[model samples]
Target: MPEPQQLEAYFALTEAVSLLQHQVEQQLRAEGGISTVQFQILMALNGAGQLTMTQLADGVVYSRSGLTYQAGLLEKAGLVTRGPSPEDERATLVAITPKGRDTVAKVLPGHIEVTRRLLYEAVPAADLRRLRDIMSRVRDHIREEPPRSAAPRRRRTS
Candidate 1:
């Protein structure tokens, strides 16, 4: 059985993350005219230079189709480009455009402000390090298997 403290911790973490995400997403949409998700996609591609669709989805914690839709928005805005991967005809690649980099540059200040206010200010310096360590371990454990929502369902035969 799971311990009570463990259960409490899990719920607390979920609540905190959900609340923080909601706040940040709203702030980004209102102040920056982009969703938090769009910012994440841009951030990943900007930092990595380029990534395949599957890689971008995994990096951004989104389903391939969901990534496609969000990438479409970015592309429509001229912030990103999606095209055939040079090395793989069967794969599509996503990359940040100069405008996308510019968008990140514009959005980063407000993003950092909200993030700092909601998260960094809430934790001590030492606790922030501990939080990062704990979250990294949790992220690794979750990535060890298929995502529950997007994973293919198993077949059963009697």
Candidate 2:
């Protein structure tokens, strides 16, 4: 078993992330009438203007097929449009409609406020800075490591 301190740290971090996700989901659901996943898709399209379906999936951490379904919903809602990619007819690109842009403008302020309340209001400024630096270091370290399957073999092959 992990040490008590390590377990506590792991649970605390998990809880923090869960709480943040819940708050965002509630706010978006109530105010914007959209699921968190849908909001994420809209936000990605709003910021990028237009992106391939694969790009949208990557930007929002969804599987490509999952993004395709969400994009269909958004298209039905008249918030987005997907068209054959000009650069690659084989790929589809998604873009936010004017209505989508308006929805995003309306929701973003509340989202920012909620985020600030959850993270900034709860921590000292110095702690927040330290947290940012630590997270960046962890991310960079993970990015630097080779994939598990690519690790060097321990024994000589025949």
Candidate 3:
């Protein structure tokens, strides 16, 4: 890839992910009656069985307070339960409810269909392994770095 194309590629990939998220968000809301963030929380909890409040927030890229608010909503909907961690009184553990599992089951077909339409169909099967390898490497590289905001800014001079 050329230098200029690399820049365009970065923006293109970002936009593609954003657009895919929007499409999935709509499907989740229409079919499962959940927001993208809620679906993300449920999805993570579903896979992990249970996670600490800190873990949940980190996995979903949400702040602790934000996760608390969303968790409250999920709890009110009877989709999840939050309780004190047995290992640590100060920590909260979140687990999915039966209703949350059912919601995931109901929404999975649409989710899969949209993912296929947006991604699987676009990439050739022969290159999928390579694509996955590249994506994983990129994710790891970025994940290892601190957020841009956490880095100090250089001094400005007139």
Model 2 stretches with alpha carbons more than 4 Å out: 139-158
Please provide, for model 1 over 20-78, each residue's C-alpha lDDT reduced to its tens digit, 9 standing for 90 to 100: 99988887787668898898999998899888888887778887678899999999999
| lDDT string, candidate 2, 2-97, tens digits | 999999998999899899999999998788878889999898888889888877765576665577888999999899999999889888989999
Task: Tell me, by TM-score, which candidate is best.
Answer: 1
Kindly report which residue pairs in candidate 3 clash with one another: none
Instruction: Give per-residue CA lDDT, model 3, range 1-158, as digits (tens).
Output: 56998989889989999999999999999999898889889999899989988788767777666889999999999999999999999889999999999988889899999999998898898787788999999978876886433456577898
**Which portions of model 3 show Cα errors greater than 4 Å?**
1-3, 146-158
Question: What RMSD, rounded to one decimal, does every model reach?
Answer: 3.1, 6.3, 4.9
* Model 3 TM-score, 2 decimals: 0.85
Would you list the rank order by lDDT, best first? 3, 1, 2
Worst 10 residues of 2 by lDDT: 145-154
lDDT: worst 10-residue window of model 3: 146-155
Sorted on TM-score, highest at the top, how do the candidates line up? 1, 3, 2
All models: lDDT?
0.87, 0.85, 0.88
Query: How high is the lDDT of residue 107 in model 1?
Result: 80
